[model samples]
Structure formats: structure tokens, C-alpha cells
Target: MSFDYDLFVIGGGSGGVRAARLAAAEAGARVGLAEEYRMGGTCVIRGCVPKKLMVFASGYSGAFEDARAYGWGVQAGGFDWDIFKGKLEAELTRLEGIYTANLKKAGVEIHAARATLSDAHRVKLSTGEEFTAKHILVATGGRPFVPEFPGHELAITSNEMFKLDQLPKRLLIVGGGFIACEFACIMNGLGVEVTQFYRGAQVLRGFDDEARGHVADLMRDRGVNLHVGTDVISMEKTAEGIAVKSSTGHDASYDAVMYATGRVPNSDGLGLEEAGVRLGRRGEVIVDAYSQTSVPSIYAVGDVTDRINLTPVAIREGAAFVETVFHGRPTSPDHELVASAVFTQPELGAVGLTEEQAREREPIEVYSAAFRPMQTLFAGRDDRVLMKLIVSQATRKVLGCHIVADHAGELIQLAAVAIKMGATKEDFDRTVAVHPTMAEELVTMKSPTRTA
Candidate 1:
């Protein structure tokens, strides 16, 4: 009947912190949040920020090489990796402090320890202190998955990759997911010899087949040894270095091996069972549309739900939950027509449905445009761009939009807004094209490549 706090949140990541801050500020509720690790969570510390910085850093080598074409007469000078690492470390420390300050500003009590639910409405911290609340929220997020192979222990996960003492001269990446691709690009572009092996026939299995093929071609041309439909069976450390034996009858050597296979929900060691909370397959917390878990007084959000593993998606879910439950505004994410981008060299941005996914329904008209971007013409680069739109035959509603080229991520944002608004193919034609922009191809495609 009585509670010590209005809400007790586990995990100080994006979802947990957002819920706590909003509950205190909007609902005037007393909130307590605990995080065993850093404050800013994966995105700020190990995932997005650091990864993007590496992306930027890696891109410079290419830029420098391309400078000569622009008559800049650039030459390679001795480069130091430690300097970049030190700068990135400083930036991470600053970001962590900001996350801490944000929580304090919202008047939420912060506990620097892991929190486990002891009962339906009670949470116990590692320090043996127990807190009771009317509601408890779990947002512990997820962890990278490294499979067991012969000498699996020799491989490192993404978390370890972030803290490597020295960058490997030759790196072997095992997996075809976004993390693996992003890291492969980063290291290879930075002059590390990288060989990426994927068990599936394609690297980005969910993306359009043509897009995957084009990206694979570009990666290979950029000096990445990409192996698809191959699996690692064993690894051995030789006097020369690490040797990898593949199930597809391939052998390779590298300074280090990274397994970016996938990630599972961080639901372990949290005593969910002790608290009567239910978890679905892969140990993801079973939550309702409102993010309330099976137990009425308990809720879960973020990667722990395993619904949408993106950082922005997690933040939106956390905000929506508070709005619906505590702030008197009912809201939910549609999760459809969501735009996403892969940060490979040329990049890939997509929204709505894939042509393959759209083909299962009634016949759809698919329009595609591919050409060298105008910028590349003047810049004297041979890089090309591909843009596509999938439209319903009957309704003419744009079913999907995809792009593979520079600024794809930036371009997809507006397309996502259009898709979210249910804009049709005619709507794109009605809008005036931005002259000479790569994205204008999306609106300018006059004919369907094929009707299915």
C-alpha cells in the first residue's frame, strides 16, 4: 500500500534515465535510478559516438588520397594512433559527466550500483540497500554475443574493441551485421588489413540484395577481404599470428579477431524470475504495448525489450512510456516506415519496405535511378549513387525509399518524414526537385525499373 519512491529504475542508460527524469519532472514523482556501469550507456560510451568518430577519422585517409586529384598535392605524413585515442578518451569523459548532470538537474536520485528486483515492487542494489516503489522499470539494455568456437576466447567483442591497447595491423571480423560492417570500414579505411567473414550469403541480410552487392563490390575495391557464406570453425595462434580456419574451407591470418555476430538482451543476473517478471525468447522482457511487463507494477524498455535496438528508438520508447502513463498523454511509436542507415564508405539509407518485402503482396511498381552524382563529376571521383522508390500499384502510395551513396543518412531523414506522413508517389513528383542534389533522383525517377 505504501512505497518509498514513486518509481525505481534499473540501468542508467538512455531508456532508464529518460524515464526517471521525465517521471520526476512531469509527474512530480520521487524517482531512484541505478547503473552499475557508466552513466551515458552504450551509445555515448562504446557504440555510436566513439564509432562515428572512428568513422570520421578513418575517412580522412581517403580524403587525403583524393586531395591530389583536387590538385592539393597531399602526401602521407607519419600518423600516430595514440593521439587520436587520447582525444577520443577525453571526449567520452566529458560526455559521461554531461549525462550525470542531466540526471541531477532532473532531481532524480542516482545510485552507482547494479539493481536487481527482489519482488514485484521492490529493488535491491549491490550495496544491500533495498528500495520499494509503486513501480519498477528495467532498462538494462543488451550485450554483444560472441559464439563458442575452438579458441573462441581468443576473439574479442565490440566492447573490448573499444578499449584495445593498440589497433591491430591485420584484423579478422566474423559476422555480417551493422557493427561488423561499420568496424570493418573503420579499420580498413584507417590502413588496417581487414578480412570480414559472414555466414550468410549476404552481409546485410535484411537490406536490398542489389544494395548489398554494390556495397560488397565497393568494400572489396577499397581493399577489404570480404567472405560471405563462410563460418569460422577454429582459431589457432601461431608464431606468426592468429590463424582462422573457416567452415567454407578457407584459412586466414590476422593480429586480432572480432566477433560481431549479434547481441542478446541483458536480462541475466537481474533476478527477474525472483521478482515474477516474465521474459520471452532470447531472454527479452515480455512487455505490453505500453512497455509494462507481465507484472503490472513492473515495466521494461530499450534494448532489453529487443523490439528496436537503436538508441533513438530506445529514447523515444522511454519518452512515450512516461507520456502515456505519467504525463496524461497517450502515445506509441508506429515502428513502421522507420529510416535507418549503414555507415559504410558510400553509406546506405532506407525507409519503409524493401522491394523483396513488398513483392509478397499484390504487384508493386519499383522505380530506381543509378548514376554518378554531380559532386563526384566535379570532384573527379568514380563513386556512383543508387536511389529507389517502391510504389503500390493500386494505391500509388510510396511503399519504400532506399539510397546508397554519400549523405544517404542525412537524405533519408526527410524521406522518413514523408513516409510517416503517408506521402504517395504523386506527392514526390509534385514537389520540386533540389537541383543537382543526389537525393533529387528519388523524386525524378520517371519510369519504373520493373513492375512486379
Candidate 2:
């Protein structure tokens, strides 16, 4: 069939850009991509990049304290939100430009407008333009979901966090997820009086119980007024910022309230259902392992499919889509043992099943260690780190690896490679430990803490 292009990709996110670029540059197919907002989408524009920078900025307060204890003369000054925000905005602009230039370099036509499905192979843009393509790809990601509550409009989500006019003196964070916990810690470290309320019994609900509990304790120790099993009953705007009534029957006023509850797939109003594309209950585009949707010519990836929502996973899904469709390789993006990190005060890095999940599946041995690392110990801080490995008794292979400490994210990435390669307990033991290092515990744990 004659078409305007070989592939028309809606949403110029990491996934969409990767697919469009690969199809055009590698496979020599004509491609076009449309993005209503920024070219870099959520991760580069708001999610990972800016959040990590905040993590870095917030850690300096603790670092200065540690430096003093270590005989280094260092004094921490007040954080300037204006200066930091200016630099942050500049960096985002630079990144967005790179994303645009790369797509154009790969010969993908870029549209700075929202695109919706007209039919199985047709796309209608907000600019009142229509294009027919041989195939269509939807890579529109997700958005922060804030529940309807009194004065909710006054509350900000993560999207507005990076763009705040000034850092709030008192910040109220709601939600039990990583986003909430991370921001609570970030604001607290930045010298804000941070109060966090999670309706759940514990924050980071889906993670390892021990690791999450340890994090919650440290957050409280680090001056985050964390209240679990509690939520805001209502919020009202007042001259003195936000007046919040809590489920605990407490009344307080905060400079700002931020909701990090969750995110919903950006699948609505995209005309997917009209085009015969199946959508899940959460509005996630339903797709096969290869990312092809119900309609033959339409496919979806990234958060739109509600698969692994990480940026790296989305990029892989995009590449796999191009491989399967354009290069005829029939690739399916791997989703197993994906390592992830919660960028809380003490980060939690995890890969594979939790001890809870492993024990339910099969007999397992859990090797765990909790100790004060040399660096923190030397600085006279009571900070502790956790290293745990869940191993299958039958196969002796490591079923899971979880680390809770500073820079756990960096550590888990290397550990993930070993776990992904099917390394066993003996294999890890055989590798000599790198002494005087926090991560050496991963290999040096000689005994199982518990066998189930």
C-alpha cells in the first residue's frame, strides 16, 4: 500500500526516537515522529536526569558533615535554588537539542505536535495534518497521577518539582512509592522541613521488606518526619501556605504539598480504541512480546505498554521493535532480572526476585549482612549498609541480589551482570573480595543468614 512514510511514530520519547532512528538510519526506511512537548520526553526532561541531579545536590549537606569529621575543613552553605534551577534548565535544553539533532541526523522527520491515530495506519496531528504510514508506533509514556482531593490543584507533581520558583521551607510529600520517598529525602537534605505521609504500612511496598524498613528508619533519622499508615484527609490553601489535615487527626501547615502517588499510562485520547488497538484496564496499550498491538500495522512500547517502565527498558523495546519489524529479526525485548534503584537517602538497588518472592517459588538460602561501612564509621556516623543475596538451594544460582547503601545503584549494575549471566553462590565466592570496599560484602558473605 502507498503510504506517506514507512513508519510513523507518535511521541518522541526515548522509545519512539530510538525506533524512528533505527528504522530510518539502519534499515533505510522512511520514518516520522511527533512529540507534543519536549523531544526528550519524561526521563530526560523531568524524570531521571533532573531527579538524579537533585540527589547529587542534596547529598552535599551530608558530605560536608562527613568531611568535617574526616579532618577536612569544609563548611556547607545554604543551597541557592535560583542558581541550581538555572543550571538545571540549561542542561535540559542542551539534552533536548541533542535528542532533536540525533533524530534529524538519522533521517527521521520530526513533528512538534501531538499525534493521534486516525485508523490502523493513519495518524492525525493536532496541526490538522494527516499522514498514512505502512506502520505506526505509539511510545507516549506515562504521567504522574494525582487523585482528586480538596485543594489538589494547589499541590504539585514531580513534573513541576524541577521548575519550582523556590525551595519550600516546609514540604509535605504524599505516597509510598520511590518517587515520594526520594523527594522527601531530597527536600530534607536540602534543608527543608520535610514531612512525608504514606498510606501503606511501609514505603517502597513492592521491595524487600528488610531493605525498605531500613530505609524508612534512616529517613526518619535524617530528619524526614515520615508517617506511615497515614494520609492527608484534606488540604486547604491559606495565607500561610497549605493547611493539611491528616488521617492521624493532626493539623499542620506546609509551604508545599507534592503527590508522587503513581503514574498512569498516556494512552487515553490517542484514538487507540477506535483504531482497534487493545488497551489494558489501566489504559496501557496491550501488545505482544514483540510490541505489536492488536492491529497488525500498529505497535506500542515503553510505558504505553505498561511493561518495564525504566528508560533503558524503553530504549531496548524500541530497538527490538525496529529489529522485529524493519529488519525482520523477530526480536522481543528482555524483561527479566531488570535491576532498579530507589534514589532515597540510602538508595536501594535490586535485581531479580525478593527473598519473599524466592521463598514462595522454591527452597532458597538468603545470605545477608548489615554493617557500618568504613567510610561512614570513620566519620562517626551510625549509618549502616545491607547486602543480601537470595540463592536457590536446588540450582545454587543466585535468585536475587539487593543492596541498600550509598551508591547502591552503581553497585547493582555490575551485580546485575553477574546475576544475569546465571552466576551461582560458589561462583561469587570464588571471586576474591576487594577489601576495604562496601561492595566487597557481595562476594565475601560465607554463610546463609536463613534457609527457606
Candidate 3:
């Protein structure tokens, strides 16, 4: 067909980059990727990298205060917002360069412009260049969705939160998802007067309820004004900063109001309508099980597909798409039992089904163990760890495992492997406990809290 490239991928985020690189290298297929903005996409530049840096920076503030209990320091520790911002920018610039170099190493052509699909097999860049390919992959990912409320323009999304010139003295974060809660903890720990407003009765609405409650308590203890069951109607700029007017008629002023409410698929401006790609109600690109859109030659991956939006999951989907499409290998991503972690203070990590999801299928059993960790015991801190196992009644298989602790992320990875391998409640009990570790609580638990 004399195609310019074997595969033309739009969006150089996690999925797009992985797909293009692997398709070029392994499939020996010519690949071209177009990105109008930063090469690394949401995770590397704004979402994960910068957020984690802020988390680390905020931890130091808490660490300095916690050090008093350990008899470590006498003098005060101070932080300069300018210094932190400069460091974050330097690291992000380095990451963008690495992403570009990776594409070059993989023999993939990179186009620094937005790509709009002219047809299922053809894409046109904003530069007025047209390229035809055997297949087109859409991996534009998603962006923070700020609702259209009065004075919403005055509110900042998570995207701008990282690049702010000055650190907010007082912050009002709206919503209760991972984005909202995570930011609240980070900023509050850094000594900001942080207030969180969520319309729902609880924060982290989709996660396990116990995990959400525990995290909520931690946020409260850390001095975050957690206001659940309230919605902000509008925001107005005050002489001081920004004033948030709640739907309940409660109003408050803060230096900045961050709408960490949610994110929408970046399916806009891609000319999908003309190309005949069906999108979901939330604007997510609808794809088949093998990552194919309605049109066979077009594929969509990453957040654009509205599947698991985690970066690792997107990378896996992208790699699988290339293998199935070009290499003729019938492959699909196994999304089940995929472990993930939320980087709030005292981190939350989980894999497989939640206790609620497990109960829906059959008569299930849940085992839990909650106690003060050794580190907290030594410091006389009241913080406790939560570990739970959700077992299938029919097969006695462990369907889900969740952990809330300091090293929950690292600990849950092993649990994820176990769940993926179909490990049961008996298996966890049979495993010997690793002594002097917080993770040991997961296996040493003996009783079932509830049997459904």
C-alpha cells in the first residue's frame, strides 16, 4: 500500500511511546509518533513524577516535626518554595530529554505536533504534513476535568498545581478522589492550611471503605480540614486570595482552590467524529478486547480507552496491541489482579477485587488485621496498619488483598503476585511470617471478620 509508516501513533505518552518503540524494534515495523506537548505525557511530567517530588518534599516537613519524638534535632528545618520548584523543573526537563532519546534509540520517528486523524489509516499533523499507515494508534491519554461552575476559571487543575510560581499559603482542594486526597496530604504536611471539600459522604469513594476511612483519619490527624458531604457551588477571587462558596451556603477563602475532582479522556480535538470512532459517554474511546476500535485498522490504548488509567497498565496494553496487530501474535492484557498504590501519607496499596466486589459473586469471607506498627510503637504514635484478605467461598481462593501502611506499595506487589497465581486463604496462612516486619501482619492473621 506504500504506507509512510507501518504504524502511526498519536500521543507520545506511556502507551503511545511504548507501542511505537516496540512496534519498531520487535515487529521490525516502521513507526511514527506525534506529540504536541511534552514527550513523557501525564505521568512523567505532571502527574506521577512531580506529585511524588511534592510528596517527598512534604514528608521532610513532617519528618522534622516527627524528629522531636526521636530526639534527633534541636534547630528548625525550613523549606524554600523557589528552591523546590527549580529542582522539580530541572528533573522534569531531564525526563523529557530521556523520553526523546528513547524514541531515537528505538528507531521511531517523532513528530512534535498534534495529530488529527483524517481517516482510519491516515493521520494529518498540525504542521500540514499527512502520513498514511497500516494502523493508527490513539494514546492521547486524559486530562484533569474541572467542572463548569461559577468562577471555575479562578480554580486550578492538577496540571497547573505543579507549575505554580509560588507555594500556596492556604489551599482549598475540592473532590475526594485519589488526586484530591493525595494533594491534600502533601500540601498539609508541608504546613499549608489545607481544606478538602468533597460532595460525597466519603473521600476515595471507589476504594475499600476501611482504607478510605483510615486515610481520612490520617488526613485529619495531619491537620487537613476534611469536609465531606459538601459541594462547592462557586469560587470568587477575594482581596486575600480565592473565596469558595459551598452549595450548603458555607464559604471560605484560600490562597488557591484546586479542583482535583476527576479527569476526562483527551479525546477532544483529535477529529474522531469525522473518523467514525465511537466514544463512551465520558468521551473515552471505545475499544475491543484486543485494543481495536470499531474500525479494525485503528486501535486505542491508555486513558483514552477508559480502561485502567495507570501508566504501567497503559504500557502493557500498548505493547500487546503492537504484538497482536503487526507481529500476528494473538495477545491481550490481563487486567485482573493488577496491583496499584496511591501515594497518600501512609500509602494505600491493593490488588485484585475489593471486599465489596468479592462479596457480590458468592458467599465470601474477609480476614483483617489492624494494629500499631513497630515503628509507630517505638515512637508512641497511634497510627495503625490495615491488612485485609478477601477469599472466595466456592474455591477458597484469595480474590483480593489490601494493605495500608508505610511500605504498603512494596508489600502489596508480592500480594499481587500471589493473587494472580490464585493463592487462597490457606496459602497466606501456610506462609511463615517474616518477623520484625510490618508486612508480616498480612499472613499471621487468624480469624475471619465476616462471612458473606
Reference-based lDDT, each prediction:
0.87, 0.94, 0.89
Q: Ten consecutive residues with minimal summed lDDT in candidate 3? A: 60-69
Encode model 1's per-residue lDDT on 38-112: one tens digit a residue. Answer: 998888888889998888888888788677767897787645688888999899999999988988888899999
Tens-place lDDT per residue, model 2, 1-452, is 89999999999889999999999999999999999999889999999999999999999999999999999998777999999999999999999999999999999999999999989989999999999999999999999998897777888999999999999999999998999999999999899999999999999988998889989998998999999989888899889989999999767999999999999999999999999999999999999999999999999999988988899999999999999999999999999999999999889999999999999999999999999999989999888999999999999999999999999999999999999999999999999998889999989999999999
Please write out the lDDT profile of model 3 over residues 1-452, one tens digit for every residue.
78999999999899999999899888889999999999999999889889989989888876665677788865666678889999899999999999899888989999999999999889999999999998999999999988898899998889998888887889999999999988998888787899999999899877888888988998887689999999988788879789888977668889999998889999998988779999999999999889999888899999999999899999999989988998899789878778988888888998888877777888898888888887766776778889988888889899988888886888889888888999988898899999989888778888888897
Task: Evaluate candidate 3 by giving its C-alpha RMSD to the native, one decimal.
Answer: 1.2
Clashes of each: 0, 0, 0
The true-versus-predicted C-alpha distance at residue 85 of model 3, in Å, is 1.4
Best by TM-score: 2
Q: Lowest-lDDT window of 10 residues in candidate 2?
A: 146-155
List residue ranges in candidate 1 displaced over 4 A. Answer: 377-380
Q: After superposition, how far is residue 289 of candidate 2 from its true place, in Å?
A: 0.8
